[model samples]
Target: MKRKIAPFILIALSLIIAVGLSACSESGRNVEEIRIGVTGPLTGATANSGVASKQGMELAVDEWNEKGGIEVEGNKLPIKMYFEDNQGKPDQGVSTAEKLFNNEEVDFLIGDAFASSVTMAIMDLAGQYEKPILSGEPVSSAISDKITENPDKYKYFWKGNVGSDAYGDSVYQTVKMLEESGDFQPTDKTVSFVVEDTDYGRSNADEVARLLENDGWKVVAYETVEVGHTEFYPQLTKLGSLKPDLLVSVFTADSSGVALVKQINETKLKTLHTAVYYPTRPEFIENAKDSSEGLVWIPLMFEPLLRESQVDFATAIKEKWNVVATPNHALGYDTMNNALTSIAEAQSLDSEKIVEQLAKLDRDGILGRFVFDDSNHTIKAGPEYIPVPAVQIQDGKNAIIWPENISTSKYQK
Candidate 1:
């Protein structure tokens, strides 16, 4: 009887030790690591914008980590970023998103520069997975239209920048201001427009043209160019023949803008040249050089008009990356920081809860005060927040020329 009791006691002791070790291993698991997935055209013609955006996100994450990361529900979780190169293609964008959602299991997502096609392609996946996606710079109205049409289906998607209509109106307002100020006077009040075939370029061009016509400006020439068309002399020469007062080229690709500006100078097109978005990039100034001079553009974020906190953030970017932060960078940084803010406010890692907090967020930061319109989930463009400044390239540098309060220089013909 003693021997049987001894064997049973030994078995019971072994079981207790095994259970204790299992509990220790379970408690040791890492639950303080939050994953964020980012996608962009990291290795294509639009790489400059993509790289800038990625750098901005990295900087924001670094800053958060330096402060011991974000605290949620009593846990200070460190952020880990994972990036996927979408190459600015719709198919690739979808695939990259799948990898981030399934393989990496990221808690949040961001990115895709300038291309609305990529942004639209990923909306379904974002909705299905219930992940909140903050778009970096895809400013097409189609994004908002879809959201407005079916809010329940695409509730997780949010835009980081103002819509193309806002940009178009700002451009029109700048020209009107110039005319009123007597800085620019065209005898015929005639205009010509050129746009890339992409959704971004065409949509902005259409809006600008519509606004110009409503303002009594005649649109004599309207043309569209393929995305990578290198030579614009044929188009510019034809438009020059029309002898319009203003020649506008709405471009999304950097190389196309550079090439078009070079051709515009070579052809000696006397009409004033204006572009959107692309001209704010450093590559535009570097590649176009003197040709880029006198060109007018609408920058989503103008550095000179930024708040002190934004200025400080820009300085930090310059110091760390050895590059001047463009509007694209600001968009990237602002979107990430906004997401972080939402996470902190929610105090939970659930994506839906974060979305709820985002809808209610109305705070100022790098990109100005961000208040999302509940109907479409986009920030309204205004001087108070997300001012679309009409900037002109004077002496190969960006100078704010509109909204007198922030104008660094008067508009010059």
Candidate 2:
């Protein structure tokens, strides 16, 4: 049995070994780290939200790596995170998504954490090549609609947050309960919208409008602006002239919100102003502190100092990054950990198995419990799951004024 192998046979065996190693992954992950391509509005428009999300994601990855990463089969792997900014642009999101996939060779993607327009830009890339994709904060129901429309086609896509439709429920119920309880009085049952032009803004505005209309409230005006557009004087002027009893606005860019609130101060409209999304951002509070007073908004689920645990967590983040953590940060942290937990459940890097575990995931996060409905590939929303409570900005603080059981304070005129 000591016969020597031919040179040609030895060369053939070497080639087979190389091919097997190369075929181990779409991206070369046989050694070193598991790469996650992180994308967000890191530099423009909703940059604050983007930065907050990135920090939370980094913290999660750092903690995971500290634990020696999730064991896959028998070996432990560490995670390496790298970010690309989408600038809140849809085209930019699509391009960076490709760069993450074909160039950086990322095994997973957490992306466009700023707005639905940006998230949807790259959402389908996962299904295109069968890679797992997770998104944070972009809650437009259209994303869920797309997934449900072709569940098999987009089996790899998962949304970390509940749909924008939940916001409709939150806004309508908050208003109705307050009215019925005599906590709020309305001279005129009219409302209007000033939302960003993107799908996230339009979708939420539409939902809020439909619900308000069902309650016999007239929708007087609906205005849309570009993502970073700050000139809200015309809209404010119109709202002042019309004198709608309520004005509901949505924006992702903190600048837009700051501008709108400041202008609202100048216009001095008497509407019970209710905002969406932006007020949760630190920049909005800092830039428009006086104007944000009495501004009602939804889903105050992750105020940095809302709880003692949040205070400790925020302190840690501040010491590390010198930035204030917000609800957006918590959302990012939860999204990352939830995805990792599913990967651990799968016990392998196989995309199909990971998606399988994702569909079955039921876990608690800083925000609340996360349970995805495979029918829509989104987290469920309700008081039992995730509460979308409305809050009024009262003297540099958020006061929960709706849903009597959890109301921290009664509505202030």
**TM-score list, all predictions:** 0.88, 0.91
- Residues 1-413 of candidate 1 have per-residue lDDT tens digits of 99989988999999899998778544433457878888888877677788888888889899889999888779988888898998888899889988988777777787454477788888778788888887778888888888999989888888767888898888888888888888788889898888888778877888888999988889898888877667888898898789899877887777899998888889888886778877877678899998888888886474633345667777878998989877677777877788888888888778889899989988786777888888898877888777888888888777888777877888767
Cα lDDT, model 2, residue 398: 86
Task: Give the Cα-based TM-score of candidate 1 against the true structure.
Answer: 0.88
Residues 23-96 of candidate 2 have per-residue lDDT tens digits of 86435555566777888888877787888888988888898998999877777888888789988888999999
Worst 10 residues of 2 by lDDT: 24-33
What is the overall TM-score of model 2 with all chains considered together? Answer: 0.91
Please report, as a residue range, the 10-residue window in candidate 1 with the lowest summed lDDT: 300-309
Instruction: List the pairs of residues colliding in candidate 2.
Output: none
Residue pair clashes in candidate 1: none
lDDT of 1 at 343: 83
Each candidate structure's count of clashing pairs: 0, 0
What C-alpha lDDT values do all the predictions have?
Answer: 0.81, 0.84
